[model samples]
Target chain A: MSIPGIRDRKIEDVGLQAGVDRLTEDQIQKTIKKVLKGETGAKLKLYAETCMRCGLCAEGCHYYMSHDKDPSYAPVSKVRQTMWEILRHNGKVSPEFIYGCAQIAYTECNMCKRCAHYCPLGIDIGYIISVVRRICHKLGVVPLYIQDTAHSHSATMNQMWVKDDEWPDALQWQEDEARDEIPNLRIPLEVEGADIFYSVIGPEPKFRTQLIYQAAVLMNETGQSWTMPATPGWDNSDMAMYTGDYEVMGRIKRAHFDTAMRLKVKRIVMGECGHAFRSIYDMGNRWLGWKMHPVRVMHAIEFYHELLEKGQLKIAKTFDTPVTLHDPCNIIRGRGLMDQAREVVKAFCPNFVEMTPNREHNYCCCAGGGVINCGPPFKNVRVEGNKVKAEQLIRTGVPVVIAPCHNCHGGLEDIIHAYKTGQELKFLIDIIYECMEKPDAVE
Target chain B: MNAAYEFVVGPLAWIAGAIFVLGSIYRLVSMYALAVKKDYSSLPYMDLKYSLRSIIHWLNPFGTAGWKASPWTAAVTFIFHICLIITPLFLLGHAVLLETFHGIEWPTISDGLADGLTMLVIAGCIFFIIRRATVDKLKYITSGMDWFVIFLVLATFLTGFAAYHQWLNYQFILILHILAGEAMLASIPFTRLSHMIFWVFIRGYMGSEFGKVRHAKDW
Candidate 1:
């Protein structure tokens, strides 16, 4: 049942409701205070005092634009509704308020960091929302699906429930599939000292096995020294960071870094996953009180660009389709790989068109930052809230859009399908694989 | 000078100065200590190059994505902040007062230029009011205190302009202008106006995160 009008479409979420039911008033209040006093420092204090509520960040937010310029959807207003809400209540958090926070933080925001960039003061509303999610996580009032994924990160060390044996099996299956084309390809697993420890998100093994297959083919054709671990830490992607389970988040990062260290690899090369790269490079490292990665890390965009630069990965055919590039927020805005990604696209896709606000200035797919992991209940809200993105894609006037990140593909696919823009999305690798020269395959 | 004028011009000035300087220093030191205590990792990435780059870009009008997003706000904000900061320091009247009171003097702007800057600040404040009233985002985010802060700033410039022009009761307006300026100074470390001091730290932290950690330009 939707509790509309009073609280603005408070949809029933079992995870949130159950989590709230399990908590007492005392527990909720104490949890909030604990997180506030222990976890936060001057950054929170400065943001709180410095915010003039100027609302200039509103124009940069897709949710604000898509929501018919609704005042509440403004980035600062979202902060007011969640973080400021907690402050106003002074830690006496109610079930209903916590519910609103979970929805707004987990579903309403993609945490794209666009608003942070758009803020004249460089105030990170995404970081503010993460603190809210952190409080909600402690209160045990998290949205169900993402919390489930976080639990998967906790228990199995992977987001999917793939067991000990399934990881290597999935890699083997992808290798066998790729071997059909390359005829001498191998997805080497658990090599002791490969230069690149190629890691990926959980979805690859469960369903998007083709991404793994293509990455393996790229590795094989380039004659690269890379390996996929058979162990639990092979999944570099994490949902725990989004779920606000910092302990689990820290553990996940540790496991990933340790796996690479144990394998004695020179670097950890991640698949086309933005959030995972963010986890390893930016967010997760800081959680462990470190400024640099334990091992060097590379995203697929950088890896491919390196290969192309070295003439290792040769382009066999230029893609004929009129393609446009969707710069994912994590890599482009968060990590700054816009020029490299565009270079790779220019190398392969001859008929490439640029979006209006290309590179770091591009809008986020509503499905990122674990908003998509919040699951089917909030899909409409996610789809409806990114009309600006749909319009952005449509304005490119290209049938094929290339997204180099996994979460971007997930979010853009939904937006395209919902808007029925008749646009198709592909990974940069998909086009790269289609157009690049393979070892032994003939057209 | 009359008693009321003397009090504002004498003891009140010293009190406001003491509070502004001491309070701002206290806030800065306390904030730094807090960061070191709980967020030590955040401090490690405080790259001077990145922080300077970020601060310089933000200080430039329309240099940031946020500024360029709405050119009108950027224009008003840059004009307002620049005039608000400049007119007080560079005005011939201020320079004369410093020379008279403390045997200190610096380069000063001509009265005509000072008049223009003061007017720009007042106009910028009016522009902000209209924006808050019209724009839904600004309207929702703004509170009663926010409105008061803007009006407080506006009053300082308006009274100074009125005093300079001798619009009505020159002595009273001049005293009012001095008091308003004092109040704004005192409010800096106490209210939303504290952004003046916090901007350095915040910009530096964000720059470090983007440039040193994420290898991106925040601007």
Candidate 2:
């Protein structure tokens, strides 16, 4: 699925190409050998040897479905093209092969883990692809945009490379905007012993500042005790884990957990971003070898569900527009929040029509797993690759799609625009903020 | 020709059995040790409750949505595995041989039933081979080794059937049958056939990761 007249077709990752070119043959060989032998354990051995390659997983992949059943996009075939090739050559593959591996592992597959559900033996192709990413990363071969985001995590302790002072400035802007509405709402900052430590991805400050305003409004209206850190550790979005830079991923997680621990908050409430939730709750903490995170954390979906279930945030009027919920893989499949997401959506927007194959079986946005973060070079493929998802949207026939994850919002927005599906994308918090009643008089 | 037949049925069978048992043991122990030493995270959250639930769902035919979605593949796979295990264990010839060698006795399927099941195994292999070859989506993953494995199983069951029916060259087919069965046995620990043993690790650990770690039902 290439756009015509574009030379930058076929997943042209210049950074990956450059990195592969800079590597000596010996470096590539040794790096692959070292990673394959040292890092992977029985998990890799079990998955590799146990796979029978029945191709049952092809039906589960949006890429395969959208591309007219191309065998190359099958989850196991992606592994064959990468891991099997490395094993076949005993780590002596050419630079061009490594570049191809990086493209397929990093961009083509979303790593959403949906196919794992389809696999009869539950072989995690996502794990194998990540292992390939780990190998490419060690060889300094990675997609340009995602690698740059990981670098930002290293330098700024944030994915967007938001400047130090600008972080709080954005919050101040939101707090003031919210106060104009509430007359007394102040986004609490650095509140010690607060019940909740609210954090968001850097995008809120960089571009989507209105999300911060909406979240602030929700917090005030609910009469919740919450604080946003006026510091670098506030941003929870992570690209390091996606890029297979676990060392940087661990550092970012530490900063986030440490910030919450320092504030003595009872829990950390992250904004609507699926990868950020995954990094903090599932992957980053696991890499740090923490049996449990120092502070309890929940995604915005869980938070909104909790608030709505307890009648803490009451609705003034049910949403008028018909809407469908897009279950982000990290939360629905990775965390089993499918029921809660549906409950929250149905409560506010009663005109809910579920897309076919909803819940854990839903197709990925094709932009997640850092494909969207890979930026404009991959945008065409990202949209075209998930025509199945666009069709899913069209099937729902809803004017709006509510995705509880920021990355899904970004991903779905692009598809809607490109496909001309004419569906507006909104966060769950956005819809709730609109329909939920604010206090009649400010405190 | 007598020497070759005796070698396959006697010494080769013994060698294959020893390797099958010992190699399988070695693989399991090494894999368990590796998990303990390197992948400690995989061990901690393996809740028996979730793991067993996940395993039970996968163990049942049409237990998962994916299995239910593609009924033909699931049916073929389940029947193939069932026949592969049941035919060899319950065949009257195998039971008598075990009783003579190890002084043990167990009820076996009648000769006619074993013949039918053996044909089913061969038919299953043929079905898989044809599916892999003709199905466009399976082309990328259908390796030379996949063909070799399917051919190995087909040859085992095919020759067993021929020797039973006393078809052309009965003595030669009998020898071929013994050798192919033994090759499949020795391959159990070294090749993808090892999946028979490690499904607990791949499917079970995945079950645990999804059910216990991620709190989602993998199946």
Candidate 3:
């Protein structure tokens, strides 16, 4: 049941090359049957049985809309192409079929769950797509870059393969960088029983080390007791969860929680990352058999909101440039931080204008859900799929786009370049750093 | 009564009704019985009040926040469901049938209103069928069962309309109408139409998940 021309687009990436080797038909069938029987439950059955194919979900999907209303891109069509085939064949499908499922589940869909909101039946299409990814993961068929990232998670306990020495070195380096601004500043490393255990994704240390400096300055300015682990658990990002490797997901989450518990922190305050927030607060915790995180988890938005509300962080000047906010889907839709995020933005930027279809209804930056982790090989697909988003940003006519999530920042960076929108993407913290009054300077 | 009428309008009617009730209950119970992991996350936003309010809010197609996302579909669907339910329950002929079978009667709508409502239902079915056939995205996802359900509802309404006007071979048309109605009743729990009962649980669970667990205002 190979889709014509679909295989032609396959990229030659190391992870894809290593992982997606042809499997025996029997192996494929057995794996599919096992997952379908074990993973799927009442909700899956109800969603499958109840969808009326009304196509209302089509309007909600940015991919479908962006792709000229391509039928194959529709959320329900994605389900029919992947999950229904498994059900219809009773898992007797071919390796070719599994490959196609991997592509759709991993590459095409962001698993943002916006379609679930528009569904009259409230079918969580994202969950269904993730189930397909799980099956693909079992079949050893996942996107190259993301699977490689997952391998990093398995080996290094982080996505970027940041080693023990590198983690501490990067922190120390950032601490020195921050001290240039505030002479007495320090990026506290593993201060046990700190009120806040601040974790960040791997990229902060690897490529975006400046973000760590900004966070340090903000923390010092606020006089908040926050310590970052000089270990693997500092990377809150999880590509394994997106790739449907739940075992690796659970392990990564366990290490993260274990790190927090070891530090005896009262709560974990994560940097501005949407999927990481979803992973810690929702998916990863649930996978580890805890109904919730053992320690309270707060996104940077919530933390910022609290700081502002408590008058701990005061804005010395409002951002002069007219700026627009990009609501990261995981935080806005996955958690209800829409109002809080806007309030924080308004505190710094008085000239804040909203993008059309803002908040929970906002379009995904199309980079989260590990799509960006699919990496450079799938760059064109990622950029093309986010045509709607590019248009949405272009419509705002604002120079700067405040994308709070790490992945959204990456995705929007690509979109801005590809679409030639001339829009600069900044994190909320970027503006906060610029506008907040320095505590040492005030005296 | 003729044997044909007796079989369809009498004993078969009771069988359909029984299947409709018991089958629907079985489906609902089995679905709810499916193991669900409890969400132990502390509520950031507790709004059981708004969760219930959202159920009613979503029912009003124009009123909900999602209306902006898919306005036309929402409007058409809202109207279609309203006409579909009202025409069957409050039609003069259906009231008479209910009184004859179960010795129960409710106020009936005027024949003119019932006729207009029936026409609206027919139009809705046609719109659905055409949309499934013509909308590229919809056409791909639509299964035989999807079209079959639409055809089945159309048949019921068409035959009932024909039987009401006494258009050619009244008895035969009436029998076809009853059989079509019975088929719809028997299939409700098994088909996509089961959303009628499942909608409560689905929408309620989603509302609670968003409103309480995730702490998002979905509406």
Candidate 2 residue lDDT tens string, A1-443: 11111213356678887898898778889999899888888888788777888988888898888888777777887888888878778888878778878888888888999898778877889989999999989989998999999999999999888999999888888888777788888889999999999999988899999988888888888989999888889989889998889899999999999999999999999888899988888888888888766689898889999998888989988987999988899988888899998998888887999998888888899988998988888788788889999999999998999888888888889899888999998888888888889994263
Candidate 3: which stretches are off by over 4 Å? Answer: A1-20, A441-443, B36-51
Q: On residues A374-428, what C-alpha lDDT tens digit does candidate 3 reach at each position? A: 8887788779988999999999999999999999999999999999999988999
lDDT at residue A351 of model 2 (Cα atoms): 95
Provide the TM-score for each candidate, comma-separated: 0.97, 0.97, 0.95
Question: Where in model 1 is the C-alpha error above 4 Å?
Answer: A1-6
Candidate 2, position B39, lDDT: 77
Q: Clash pairs of candidate 1?
A: none
DockQ of 1: 0.73
Q: Where does the lowest 10-residue lDDT sum fall in candidate 2 chain B?
A: B41-50
User: Which prediction has more favorable lDDT, 1 or 3?
Assistant: 1
DockQ of each: 0.73, 0.73, 0.50
lDDT for A115 in candidate 2 is 90
TM-score of 1: 0.97
Order of candidate numbers by DockQ, starting with the best: 1, 2, 3
**iRMSD values, candidates in order:** 1.3, 1.2, 2.7
lDDT by residue (A1-443, candidate 1, tens digit) is: 11222167787889999988887767778888899899888888788778988888888889988989888888898888778767766678677778888888899888898887788887888989999999989888888899899999999999998888998888888878777788888988889899999999999999999999989889988899988788989988889999889899999999999899889999999989999988998889888867778799999999999999999999989998899999888998888899999999999988999997888789999889999999988888889999999999999899999998888899999999989989988998898888898867633
